[model samples]
Target: METNGTELRISGVLGRLEAVLERENSLIGTDARFDITASNAQKSRCLYELNLLMKSMEPSDLPRAAGDRLIRLRSVVETNATRVKAHMEAVRDVTDLINEAVQAAEADGTYSMDTFRPAAQ
Candidate 1:
């Protein structure tokens, strides 16, 4: 099979980008960064792939298949972000409660880690 020069160039560009990203390794798992670098990288890759896919498609082909896929991908990303935010919020709330309890116990001048421990069975 033969391909146009422009298509080959586009494919080459995407291939090189993917290779570079793969070599960089994950920045998410156990990094001590103040920011969530891994999540940001994943989000960036998703957006970049979507852009490349849309840009590569013919104008006439964009109405049905690609449009639907883009919609679904965006919806999934949004849902995941919401769920993660909700979970983090819940954890923060629990932590605040624990800190408050500890402070209250400390105010009485008898607070200790033992006070927060579960009772023996």
Candidate 2:
């Protein structure tokens, strides 16, 4: 089988993408210093390269191994996406709870009996 530039490029992109997905997955809930901005940038670049490569190649022409790798990479990306989404939801729920507590505290004030006393009936 003859290897073409497009096939090679696609494989390279997939490799990089897989690494990024693995890193992102590992970072989830691991430490306080894990930042996703750089990983996200790399992921975006890999996806852009992959999209361009896919557009240039016919799906039927891709090597079987390359196709399999693509499927695996896709699965990893999807799983990591779900993990990130779940983490975001947890953070949002905590934030909402904190905000509610703050609002309640602000509304409650120092709780003086005079403030609650009804006007002379």
Candidate 3:
């Protein structure tokens, strides 16, 4: 069941963890992070882990990428998460305000800017 265009990437830790599931795929960072396995199986397992994680993750309240030009974009993940959440919330608020304003306009049978200014400060 393929969804939209693929834009998901799971953490490296999870990738190595998946590799460890098989005796042959994990790398040898001298830790459980190294496993050796066939290329195809490794790829498939990685895709699966990424899917599992992405589906489970919830975006954060604020949106940003922590490291834009660092050696490794290690912190961008959380920032991306936060940004996703903030974008969703912001869109929701806009939609709700528009709906409310539309309802008000309908009820009054007039679309005058003076009356539909939304009670500005």
lDDT of each: 0.55, 0.83, 0.46
Runs off by more than 4 Å, candidate 3: 1-74, 111-121
Best-to-worst order by lDDT is 2, 1, 3
- Model 1 / residue 42 / CA error / Å: 1.8
> Which should have the higher TM-score, number 1 or number 3?
1
Q: Report each candidate's C-alpha RMSD, comma-separated, in the order given.
A: 10.8, 5.1, 19.6
Candidate 3, residues 3-114, lDDT tens digits: the string is: 2222223335344533433333222222444332353366567657656655744543111221121214334334434544565587699999999989997788586656
lDDT of 2 by residue, 25-77 (tens): 98876866878778789999999988877775677878777899977777897
Superposed by TM-score, candidate 1 places the C-alpha of residue 5 at a distance from the truth, in angstroms, of 10
State every prediction's TM-score relative to the real structure: 0.43, 0.79, 0.33
Return whichever of 1 and 2 wins on TM-score: 2
Error of 3 at 121 (Å): 47
Q: Is candidate 1 or candidate 2 better by lDDT?
A: 2
Clashes of each: 0, 0, 12
Worst 10 residues of 1 by lDDT: 21-30
CA displacement after TM-score superposition, residue 37 of candidate 3 (Å): 33
Ranking by TM-score: 2, 1, 3
Winner by lDDT: 2
